[model samples]
Target: MNTIEQQLWEYIDGDLDEFSKKAIEEKIKSDARIKVQYEELLKLNSAFSALDLDEPSMSFTRNVMESIALAPAPVAMKTKVDKKIIYAIGGFFIVSLLFLFGYSIYSSNLSMPKLDFNFNFNLDRYITPTVLYSFLFFDLVIGLVFLDQFLRKRINKEH
Candidate 1:
């Protein structure tokens, strides 16, 4: 808007200092254009003041609160699971198993029987090419499933 309109608005809103107010008042009186603009603004202000503001119903707040309550709570992407505690538990089990195995071996007499390490293993009888291929295919499928789950989890975390 023009400077005149700005000054007129400030004067109408009673935002100007006494000196500026006097100056604008004199201008409004002397200038017909300013006088007309001032009158129009005054009428507009009065019309705005006369308007009946529409208010929401008494239950508006309650309805909004109820809707908000009905919404599902958001899930956090990362929950704090102490990896150190998990590792400690797993380490304890592994150490215990090793200790038990060593104890059992020690309890057995030191004069143990000498056993032959050589064995005549027949791989063709149990693991044929078809069985090997099927096992590999099964492993591949399981790997893909794990990969898919990992990617889905990563995508969910990013979002």
Candidate 2:
């Protein structure tokens, strides 16, 4: 802002020192433009002072306080799982997986069992109903989890 405008605002806000005020008063008396601006500013200041501010309805504060009072107390949405159990399960899976992998690698160098001249081989030595059931159960759980995640993603995408 120009020095004159700054001085005028300072004067309007009652912030000017005596010497500054005198200087601005002299400038206003000598300069017609400054005097006109001063008059317009004075009119705006008076109009603003005369204007009444709007207030909310009488129940507004009470309603707000009441709504606040009526609001639910916050609680955690996610429950905490036992870290030890998670770690133990993870470690068990890792160790078992590593053992299976290492055993497969180690045993792969060994010879495969050959069928006799009679073309009879024992399948029971390699697989059992318990293993089959376990495998199916694992597959079912994995498929269900995958389907759950896929459906969740699809539903979320639709939304």
Give the per-residue lDDT digits (tens) of candidate 2, residues 1-159.
888888898899999999998989999999999999999989988999999999999999999999999999899778565576566557657866875675465445444467332433445565566975786687577658756766886797689
Candidate 1 on 12-79: residue-level lDDT in tens? 99999999999999999999999999999999999999999999999999999999999999997877
User: Which pairs in model 1 have colliding backbones?
Assistant: none
For every candidate in turn, the CA RMSD to the true structure comes to 11.3, 10.8
Which candidate number has the best TM-score? 2
- Candidate 1 CA-lDDT value: 0.80
Model 2: lDDT to the true structure: 0.77
Candidate 2 shows a clash count of: 0
**What lDDT score goes with residue 123 in model 2?**
50
Clash count, candidate 1? 0
Q: Who wins the lDDT comparison?
A: 1
Worst 10 residues of 1 by lDDT: 116-125
Off by over 4 Å in 2: 1-3, 56-59, 79-93, 96-159
